[model samples]
Target chain A: MSSQAPETTQIHNIGYRSYDGPRLGRAYARRALFSQSLRGAYGLGRSAKSKVLPMLLFAVMCAPALIIVAISVYTKADKLFMEYTQYAVYLQLVIAVFLASQAPQSVSRDLRFRTVPLYFSRPIERVDYVLAKYGAMASALFVLTATPLVIMWIGSMLAKMDFAEQAKLFGQGLVSVAVLSVLFAGVGLVMAALTPRRGFGVAAVIAVLTISYGAVTTLQGISYTTENTGSIIWLGLFSPLTLVIGLQNAFLGAPASFPGEMQVGAGTGAVYLLVVLGLVAACYGILMRRYRKVGL
Target chain B: MIATESLSKRFPRVTALDRLSLDIGPGVTGLVGANGAGKSTMIKILLGLSPATEGSAQVLGLDVRTHGPEIRERVGYMPEHDCLPPDVSATEFVVHMARMSGLPATAARERTADTLRHVGLYEERYRPIGGYSTGMKQRVKLAQALVHDPKLVLLDEPTNGLDPVGRDEMLGLIRRVWTDFGISVLVTSHLLGELERTCDHVVVIDGGRLLRSSSTSDFTRTTTTLAVEVTDSDAHPDGAASLRAALAAAGVTIHAGVEDGLPGAGHVLLLEAPGEETYDLVRDTVAGLGLGLVRMEQRRHHIAEVFKATDQEEVPAR
Candidate 1:
């Protein structure tokens, strides 16, 4: 390793040392990116101001469950006041706001600042970065969607409800929350990825979430009032929240969280499940294409 | 440590690299080119961040196509553009970058501190990068590239936006990356003159083509011009003119040197120093003219002269 320059011309000692330790390689790099993204979702490693919105939304989401617990304990009821599977449905706006504000924290900052090239230049591949960000968003959404159900489950026990019935309902709620997490994460990340501006991404995600739910609910209200059974049952397929509720109602025998007179059959529930999986796969496909087009 | 064979990259609008071949061994090598002359494009290809449209390349004996992750594991890169997140502290960012290179947590933090200190960022490393001076931001960029302790580092325009003093300090740090830690460096710059002082070998490219590649010593070997400067006095307002006339009268070759200002401020006289006797003749000539000899030295060729030679050849053919 002799250089053309004279070897005697020594460099000053800055205590520079070469690393000879074991390098963990690609899998480790992917995991590090995932953990960083997850922490970033809740503003854990960022400034205090960044922590405000996500934490506030989270507290707002859990407020109703806490209040219900207080009411149940005061009354000394035989059961918890609220259904576990229907908790997220009642506070869907809170979950939407959380997803809108935090999704950009996980994905858009890197794209906007053009730091995506730095990640791509590392040992990890392009898909690893997309997957890590997607996974973090989904995990964060899962926690947001599931925390209230656990609180209500605890409240059910405190209210002296039957353990077997409450645990079964809690498990069903967990399954529904997991499905909702994946669906919302896919949709939120795609919207965030579409725009590099954080403000615009937030606006876009909130608009998509609100507009789709608003339009579907309005149409379902009309169909239910007019007694249009066919349209009422199928209209729930248009929005992510309704889609998960339809799947839950059909497969898990959970009580309907839907609007008037809408009943989701087993076959319709199967279709809802397929659409959710298809939409998530499409989001991942779009993310891969987006990163590929971005030059190093 | 890097070898490329007929590497060429083409876009729909223009070609960024064309049939460029090079063999760079251990030490500091400077890739000289103008802005958009394929310097960044070439570095991206070498680091396997971008694929070459034609031909093949290898870094540290690993093919860029099949073994990109393997090559990137051993080769570090600092991009030409600003790629840092402004909200994070330098230590925080560098540690994350080190972890991205697959160093464990404790190792990442230790190396980040060491690398930041080596790059001359001390207390400032704790501050958010948005508040940093351009020079400090550049240092953070360099620190991350070196934090992983790769075997080779490809630095793209490491002195892009710095004052003269900052540029020198950065160049000194780049040199130390090789001299201190035994890491081979391939640094790129649009300015050719700066690399002449720091690089052992220099490669020049233009319009996506290889203009010239040679050791820095060979590129800047001494020319035959002996530069002479004489002091100005009231008796001889233009001593260089008097010395030039005297030297020509003595049958010595002469050429007009670069003029710095008004003629009276002691201009340089370029004399042909064919042999050792030319120095003696110049000394005798200055004494005969009753002129004070300010300085006499043989001029060495500059790395910039390579482009000048090429430009001169191209103008006539056109």
Candidate 2:
């Protein structure tokens, strides 16, 4: 067609609605994030295969409590081999493996896929993001460690123990488990946030745990042979696992589970708690700073 | 709506956004730039996800430096690269994001459903995102951004990995995000043609600087040249040559289009139409010469031509 003029313009009305709903502020955003990340740590709302690893690790961590209970019931024994607070020390390797395996599932996946931008672009601050992550991981570890502690208490009750003493022990065990889980959660999340790859994060977390445990044990062993109690207490303060046991021994009135005569006193246990808290604070700082520039 | 004054972003090695000053109103605006032209950097700074090295900006009347949380609450952002986690279902992910945006439990699910349906991913939305196609993943990203119904959305390279048909649908959807939802959209793309069809206004940037910012109509103005195509016939198989001669005899000027060695100028003619009278004259001349007029329309400047013309003119944005 030949035309000197162009086509006419017509406007179409699609009736696009404007949203006038109520939008809650930053507090709601942080609460929702904390809940979501808590689910993410346990692989909740994710695929079946994703759920498998966390669930299996959880079951493995609970095995010793179930076994000790069964043995106590069968033998009709009192005062079982595993103390509630000492459980963490007895299964430190398993707990370390669980933390190494599960921590990356919570934080590193966001970094690996560069989804940190999505999280940071919301109403929440960088500090809020790490806090939510810390809360979620700590909650997951509490569930893992406390379930076994409860099971051991049930076994003690079934074995005709003094109900009063068992209840007291359970209370102390809960506190110890809570504190130790905080330590593990803080360290695990920090290591996971430092690297994007899941395998590298897992290896780094396990290496931190294992290497420190080995170094502290060797030093404490040498100190014990030389009858150097001061040196043993000093070296015990360095490893998180040792400090965890030290805190349990000093506060819960539980006997020392460490090798030889390296019994941690109440003063040393108080120092351990302070130092563990410092480590947790340091981890939180690293996480907040890491995310501040990650989105850019 | 977004406004920036002397905004700049600098890294150690390169400057991303340099003295960018933009005033965008509520509508669908397209930000066009090449790779590494600071498109992503501009979006980040506007969202307050990153700080500007110098100057300041505002989104929805909120300061970028002080009100990042408030601005982010009202503005949705879809990043350029793939950032979806692989293990979660699309519904789960979008609902989670909606909740993060402050929608309650039931409201979050309802909005997630509506947004997923609008993006055209129904049955597949239940599957893990790891198994989704690139188009599906892109749609999921869009769904998450829209599930909470923000006042404005910033979509960066929404059609990066789609086929032609998928690109067309995504472009149409982006246009409707404004038309149907009454939301302002700041969508970016490297391809100018993609924006030409959807955007009401376009801002072109090159090398971290503003090259042009104008309404779509002004950017593509109708020029004086008109294209005339003719069909060969038994009376005059060489219709173009005959038409040119007859028009020249009739006091009409024709420019040399594509050369054809034989003065016939192939099947098309580029006529310089000084006025409406020229079009009628050319039409009457073709009919008088016993030739069929295939098409005759005024040519308009394409968006790509702006870049080529700018290269020659070397004019910066005013």
How high is the lDDT of residue A19 in model 2?
52
Which candidate should be chosen as best, given lDDT against the real structure? 1
Give the per-residue lDDT digits (tens) of candidate 1, residues A207-253.
Answer: 99989989988998887778775787688888888888898898866
Query: DockQ of every model listed?
Result: 0.66, 0.53
> Each candidate's fnat, in order?
0.72, 0.70
Which structure among the candidates has the greatest DockQ?
A: 1
A1-296: candidate 2 lDDT, tens digit per residue: 45856588777543433455677767888889888878876778776777887888888888989999999889988777777888877788878888898899889999998887887778887878888889988988888889999999989988988899889988999998888888889999999999899999999999999999999999888878888767877787787888787888888767886767567777877898899889889888888888877864
| lDDT, candidate 2, B112-157, per-residue tens | 8888888889998988899999989999999888888898999999
Flag clash pairs in model 2: A16-B180
10 residues in a row with least lDDT, candidate 1 chain B: B257-266
